[model samples]
Structures are given as structure tokens and as C-alpha cells.
Target: MVRIDDLQVFIRAADNGSLSAAARQLDLSPAVASAALKRLEAAVGAQLLARSTRSLRLTVAGERYLEHARAALDALQSGSVALAQDRQALSGSLSLSMPSDLGRNLLRPWLDAFLQQHPGLSLQLQISDRVADLYRQPVDVALRYGVPEDSALVALPLAPDNRRVLCASPDYLARHGAPAAPQDLRRHSCLRFILGAAVHERWSFLRNGERQVVTVDGRWHSDDGEIVRNWALAGLGIAYKSRLDVLADLRAGRLQPLLEGYDTEQTPLYLVTPHRLMLSPAAVALRAHLQQCLDAYLAGPRAGEGRNDSCD
Candidate 1:
């Protein structure tokens, strides 16, 4: 008979691509995890994994069984959740990935309030500007800007009205003078954020019903979005950033919006998961809660009508 625990271990190992990493996530010792995999293989009557000293690969049989195994686990979890008398008493570990600026400035307070409401829950937050792999990494969900590139993931929009805007400090504008047109950016210093190998110096905007792409250059660049925002705040250069990341600064008069006549392109904010069925109850609740929070924030007085942050 194939034990359910053994199947779970097998599935986790496959998802992580390493037995030791999966073992740590599941809180199982290396020996026990290895034994569980062997038991699962014995019950299935196939060598489910091809293992070398450095890596592990799923065999054809393992590949065939993976989807079914995931479904089985999901069904079990669903049944368990259905039996709970208090649906609001959510208890589980949730691992999340998000960008540095948003995580530190905006979502931190929201997440703290969320955890307070459900004291049974624990959170593991991975804060970085780099994109995380939901399929291969230990992250359960990721809050990301822009459309997802991977078709295998499910993207739940948290803020559809979120957009990027070009901004600079008043001091910087006083010193360099604000650009009246996209082409005018060539004469100004711009701070850029790097995503992987690509520098995000190309900015897109719409003017007079026409799209314009401007290749910008700056005196400094960084991999972290927060660093770029900081540079813009310090009166170093102009920066194109998500409105959500700079809304407080913009409202506080620390940063001034530039090129109000032109419309900057909008990118969506999403809560992405590797598999819909694999999402835990905690993840589901959190997604809904975040959506509500964002909606309320957008509707609040601070988010005044016809504001650029409204993405209208």
C-alpha cells in the first residue's frame, strides 16, 4: 500500500528538485525522507527518480504520476479543511515573495494586520527585487508587478489600477528643470532599476493617442527598486516607478510627478501561485483580504479622484 505521507514526501522532493531541500521544508531528516521515497517507489513498482550525486530527475513514471499525486493531496487537504468548525481559524505556514520597495513600505503593515487577525498563521517573507520561481522555490505565492510570463501559474489581480509614473524630488526639479516632453529626458539624469541582466532604462508613455518608447540613461543604477527610489528621493535623478511604491512620498510632497500631460503605461499587480489546487486555505484567505485592502485604499480620501495612482 502507498502511504499518504510517503506520497507527499515524493511530491515535495519533485517540486523542490532536491531531496535534502524538500526534507528540510517538510521537517523530515535526510534518512527518513530517503526512506519515504524508497517506500513510495516500492509501492509503485518503479524507479520514480533518476538520482546522481549532485541532482535528481523524475523518471517517466514519476512524471506521469505527479499530477495525480498532487490532486490526491489537494483533495485530502480540502476534506480536512471542510471538517473544521471555524473556517476563519486559519492555521498554516505561508511563504511569500515580493519586491523590496513594496514589501518594506506598503505591504508590511497590511501583512502585520493580517497576521494579527489570524494568530494561528505563520509567515515567511522573501523580500527581493528578483523574480522568484514558484515551481522550483519554496515560496507558496508571489506578489508581482506586470503580467506573468509563465503560463503554468495562476495570477490573481490584487490591484488592477496600479501603474508606473515618472517622478523626481522638488530639489532635483529645481536644479535640473522638469522635462516637458519624453525627448527632453535626454538632458536629465535618470535613475534606473535592473531586472536580471536587463536595465529598465526604456520608458513607455502615451501622448496624443500615440505610444512613445524612450531609451533613457542615468549616472547611477541598482538592482533594487528601493535603491532607485531612494536616489530619486535624494534629488539624484528622475525615476519611473510603480505608484503604489511612491504614493506616500508623492502625497507628502517629497516626490513630484513629472510629465502629467503624458499617460504612463499601466502594469498590473498580481498574487501568483504555481498551481490553483495546491493553494492552502491561508493563501486563499490572504488573497481575498489583500484584494479588499487594496480596493479600500484606492477608494480612500488619500487616493483622491482622478489621481494618477488610480490608473484612470
Candidate 2:
């Protein structure tokens, strides 16, 4: 196969009318330029240059090939530039699956901003709390809170530092009072989530290296995480949720975080792709943007949105 570098060498040598001078212009050694010219001629099965001891010039075949070679190089350069531009620009459809709570509540603003930035792009978002089946679903990408269970799927960590936040509405806390400790949760109405067949009534927290598992009961329970968040917001019961899901609510003092001193179980968010994303430029850009939002959530509560860090 004739290399692009060899083609450049041939063109330069022909244009300059000196093999050694072409080497100087291309910043190549004289030997390398000579070898490239020989390789190009051999690949084409035609002697493109007629060189003697004193003078060098193109043969009859060389004059005919020069224009064609120049066009081939031009075409390649144009194709390369177009490919680069396509990669840089975001367009076309972005099919995504996201959790009900995070999708509907937390990411609405982020999605809005993204859409505004790319007018040519469109979104197909499936909002649900149930884990999306990449194989069965029409989703290109999925934003999930937990560590990816499927080893086959490619998981991109958006926020690896993300952890669950135990919280309740100020109204709910004002009514039922807050739990003083993890043990006290047993006495409180803890809103739970039911994933498939398993009930998540057992809330776990780490206090001073000791793990506490409190199995509390509540009247409100659902498979949908958003439902659990709504129930918590309506002052139904204490809900353990992702900080990113309830960041806006927390900022507005609608939900008050509990057990700040104690560590809640990690629920690192991941962007799962079925086959290494089959990802486009838009998908890659969106992932980066979403991660920034998640990072901001992990940065802790903002100023003036402060709550009493004291656990009671």
C-alpha cells in the first residue's frame, strides 16, 4: 500500500525538481525521501520520475499521475476535516433512560439547558424507577443510581462519591419529630421502596465505623422512587433518597437531611451503555454535563440553604 507520506514526498520531489531538496522541504532525511519515491513508483508500477546524476525530472507517466495524485490527497484531506467536524458537533437523536425521581425532578434543568444548546438535537427520554433492560429496551444510554449489576454493560461513573441521604420534610419532622439515632428510626414511620420483590424497609447507616440496620415500617411504600420522594415531601414519612434527586427540595428547605454525621450507604451514579455507548458526540457531551451537575450535588448544601447539621 502506498502511504500518504510517500505521496507527499513524490509531489514535493516532482515540484522541487530535486530529490535532496524535497527532503529538506519536508524535514525528512535524504535516504527516507529517496525510499518513499521508490516505494510510490513501485506501488503504482510506473516510473514517475526520471533521475540522472546531474538533473531530475518527471517522466511521461509522472506528468499524467501528478494531477490525479494531487486530487486524491485533496479528497482525503477534505474527508478527514469533515469527520473531525462531525465528531465535534452534537446532532441527531439521543435516546436515554433515567430514574423516575432523578429524571423528572433533578435533571429537568440540565436537560433543558442541553436542548437549548443543541437546537438540531432531539431527546427520547424514558422516565421510570425500574431498572432499564438495555437488551430489551430502545435505550442507547441509561442514567442509574446504583452500581451496575450487569458485568456485560459498560458503566461510566458520573458521581462515584454519591451516597444516599436520609431525609424528611420539615413538615413531617415537625409533626412526628425526628429520630435521634438509627435505632430511633424503628420508632418513626420510615417511607420505604420496594424494588421488584424485595422490600427496602431495612435502612442502613454507618455511625463511627459501626453499621446500623433499622427495619422500620411505614404506611407508604412503592416500587417507584419518585413516589417515595413525593410521599416524603408530603410529610408522610422519613425517606432515604439520593442527594441529587432531592437537591432542589433540600435547597428550598422542603426536605431536611437527617443523620448528617452518620454515613449512608453509597449509591454511586453510573451511565450504563449496552455496547460501549454506540455513543455519538451528543451522548458523550451530555454525560459530561450530567456529571458536573452530580458533582455539584456532592459538593454539599449551598450557602443560605444550610440546615442544622446537628442530629437529634
RMSD of each: 4.7, 17.3
lDDT of 2 by residue, 79-172 (tens): 6645755766666898899888888766776787788878888999999888887755668899988878776466889888878889999998
Among these predicted structures, which one has the highest TM-score? 1
TM-score of 2: 0.67
Q: List the residue pairs that clash in candidate 1.
A: none
Error of 1 at 311 (Å): 22
Q: What's the lDDT for residue 239 in model 1?
A: 96
Cα misplacement distance, residue 253 of candidate 1 (Å): 1.5
Q: Report the lDDT of model 2 for residue 308.
A: 24
In model 1, the runs with Cα more than 4 Å from the true position are 1-88, 302-312
TM for every model, in the order presented, reads 0.75, 0.67
